[model samples]
Target chain A: MSPWAWVLAAYGCAALLVGGYVWRLWCRYRHVSRVRLGEADG
Target chain B: MRPFAVGATAALLSVGLFLALWVSPPDSYQGEYVRILYVHVPAALAAYGAAAVACGASALYLWRRDLRWDFVGRAGAELAALFSGLTLLTGMLWGKPVWGVWWAWDARLVTTAVLFLLYVGCLLVRDLADDPERGRRLSAAVAVLAFLDVPVVHYSVVWFRTLHQGPSISLQGVKLAPEFLLPLAVNTLAYLALLGVLLAERARLASLEVER
Candidate 1:
């Protein structure tokens, strides 16, 4: 592969990995917040 | 995880990416591939910052014996591990085209690998310990000790003959061209902002777990 290919792949992988992590964190935050809210409502 | 902070980070990163890929000129020698530096360098710096935060929080935990400090230390360690993994991944990708090899036993690479593993071990120690308090104390100590590898990773290129290049931008002056420097600076700020968002969310999740 060309150098540009490598560069693009590297940046692409970094974006996916970091983005996935942030998404996971966001999901967990939402879940926990919902749980807490439910308990409050109860 | 405030909506405003997340939205701002996304917008900042979008602008940074646009500048890095489109506006910045290619390196005279390295050409377009040099764009990888925008991601690689920021990931490395963010990893180092996260590790430093972990080290400081670990020390605080040990000193005050507070669970809150332990929570903060854990969050920092997790982010450190994540960014370090990204650093190594991007480094290997960058290395393959430039150095003609994907992996090397050079001082900088080896030290960074060790640093990544050390934090992973810290996380394992926290997870596998039998008691919550015992786990926090043990992992706090591990976090502190693991941080000893950080300076080694940073100075490995200087202290030894290595395949890695020396620092490009430092206290002396900017080494990169103006076009490259601007995007690099913006991307670094964007990465730091992302780190802040991640750390805050992680800590909040951890606190919720403890309360439950």
Candidate 2:
């Protein structure tokens, strides 16, 4: 594989993994907020 | 609430990324691989900055028995750990090609790896402590001691290194051409500002959690 291809692939994979993690983190934050709000109302 | 702080951080990051990636000239030696400098070096510096904050906060907590300082210590410690992990990952990726191996037992690499592990251990300690107060104090003590390595990690190359370049743009004073310096400086500033904001947010969350 070309050097550019290797670099792109490595970065792309890392971005995907880190992006998924950030999404999960955001999801968890949302879930916590919703749960907290529900508790406040109940 | 702090619009100015948020705006400054965003702007810094934007400019930093732009300059580091596009403006900086390719390294005479490394070519495009030099681009890794924008991320790896900044992350490393940010990690050390966070760790230093953790150390200072840890000391304050120990001396005053203040929970607030402990909170700062914990929050910064978490961030430092995250950045340290990123630095190591990027370093390895950059290393494999340059050094011909992904892993090395050189002094700089070894010390940095140890530092990262120490922070990870700290995270576990905080989680394992049953009482918040007790946990914070204990973790603070640990953080203060562990941070001694911060200087060693920073100077590892100068002091003793198995493999790793010496200080580049930071101390060399305009060692990087405009293309690289602009983005690198911007990114470094952005990462630092981001670190501060994240620590503040984490501290706020911890305060609220405790109140609850």
Candidate 2 per-residue lDDT over residues B33-98, each given as its tens digit: 666767777887888888899999899989998777777898878877877777777777766765
Best by TM-score: 1
Q: What is the DockQ of candidate 1?
A: 0.69
For A1-42, candidate 2 gives per-residue lDDT tens digits of 343443454445435543554465456556667777888999
Number of colliding residue pairs in each model: 0, 7
Tens digits of lDDT, candidate 1, B1-212: 39999899899899989998899888775677778888988888889888888999999999999878887899899989999999899888876776667876555566667779999999999889999888899988999998986676657654554345654322124257787889999999999998888887788888997776
Residue ranges of candidate 1 with Cα displaced over 4 Å: B152-175
Clashes of 1: 0
Q: If you score just chain A, what TM-score does every candidate get?
A: 0.85, 0.77
Instruction: Supply the global lDDT for candidate 1.
Output: 0.83
* Candidate with best lDDT: 1
lDDT (0 to 1) per candidate: 0.83, 0.71
Tens-digit lDDT string for candidate 1 (A1-42): 766788789889888999898888788878888888999999
